[model samples]
Target: MSPFLPLATVIGCGVVYHVAQKASGAVSPWPVLTIAYGAAFAVALFMLGLGWWGRGDAVRWPAARDCVASLALGLAAFGIEAGFFFVYRSGWPLSSAQVITNLSVTAVLAVTGIMVFGEHLTGARAVGLALAAGGATLIARG
Candidate 1:
């Protein structure tokens, strides 16, 4: 698969996700998330089945560390969903909210990717990061 495919998917979903989240902000976050996760679970099961059938991969018990990592990921997903829901409900415009959150996440993850994952950060990328931070600050204040 082309690398851009997944990036485009995330970008498209993010656009709709924010609109849906803002629309549903009147409802409690937990209930909204419960339904969202339920749907995600259903889709996950279907995808697992496809993997089993197509890739000859059978579902098996994950290792303890993998399980812990998966559980942590779930917790983080909830935090992202609920945190944004509350922030939107609290009157943060989606424009600023997404910009602020995405830039901050990008910056932090860039550091972690370099330090923990041994990813290289080029000089040009550093300049881009600085520009992103400055843009985020302007959007947040404007």
Candidate 2:
């Protein structure tokens, strides 16, 4: 599959996710998130099972390292979900909130990619990062 397909899918889902989140702003955050996560868990489990069946393979338990990484990702995802719910409920507009959050995350990930992953940081990328930060700030202020 093309990488762009997955990227576009994630972007599309993110758009829908924020819209639904804004619509549900009046509901209790925890209960709403609980139902959301429950559905996600179900879908994830079903996908796992389907993959195993299609591959005619037994369910292999994840390695310790993989398990640890996945756990960390899950924790981070929970934080993101809960944080955004509260942020939106607290009167942050969806447009600005999404822009700021996504831009901030991109900036942090760019630095992490360069520092921790030894990815090259070109001059162009540096300028882009700075501009992204400036844009995010402007969006937040306006």
Candidate 3:
């Protein structure tokens, strides 16, 4: 499969996610999170069904132990969304909020990638990250 479709889906959904969170700033985050997660669950299930049919294969649901990662992912997703919602509620402009969060998370993950994953910080990657950092600084300053 071409990466273009997957990347477009991610970018599109990210836009919608931020807009929805910002628009629903007046509501309780928990309830909103509940609804959003429920919808996400439904969508995941639907996608799984579609993939199974498309491939003409039996469902390959993960074992209980294998689902542990998904459980952790759910918790992390909740925390991320709630944190963003609170940030928006605290008067963070939509433009800078995601920019700051993404850049900060990228920096942390880059460190983790290097230290824990033993991934090399190649010169090209370093320059890209530096440029991102500089852009984030400008965004935050505004």
Ranking by lDDT: 1, 3, 2
How many clashing residue pairs are found in candidate 3? 0
lDDT of 2 by residue, 1-142 (tens): 5779779989999999999888884567788878989999998899788775356567778999999999999999889888888888899998899999888888889889989999998999999989988999989999
Those runs of model 1 whose alpha carbons end farther than 4 Å from true positions after fitting are 52-61
- Please, what is the TM-score per model? 0.89, 0.89, 0.90
Model 3 clash pairs are none
Candidate 3, residues 48-130, lDDT tens digits: the string is 88785366577777888879987998888889989998999999989999999999899899999999999999999999999
Predicted candidate 1 versus true structure: per-residue lDDT over 12-121, tens digit per residue: 99999999998884568888899999999998889788875456577887899999999999999999999999999999998899999999999999999999999999
Scored by TM-score, the top model is 3
Scored by Cα lDDT, where does model 1 land? 0.91
Overall lDDT per candidate, in order of appearance: 0.91, 0.87, 0.88
lDDT of 3: 0.88
Highest lDDT, which number? 1
TM-score comparison, 2 vs 3, better candidate = 3
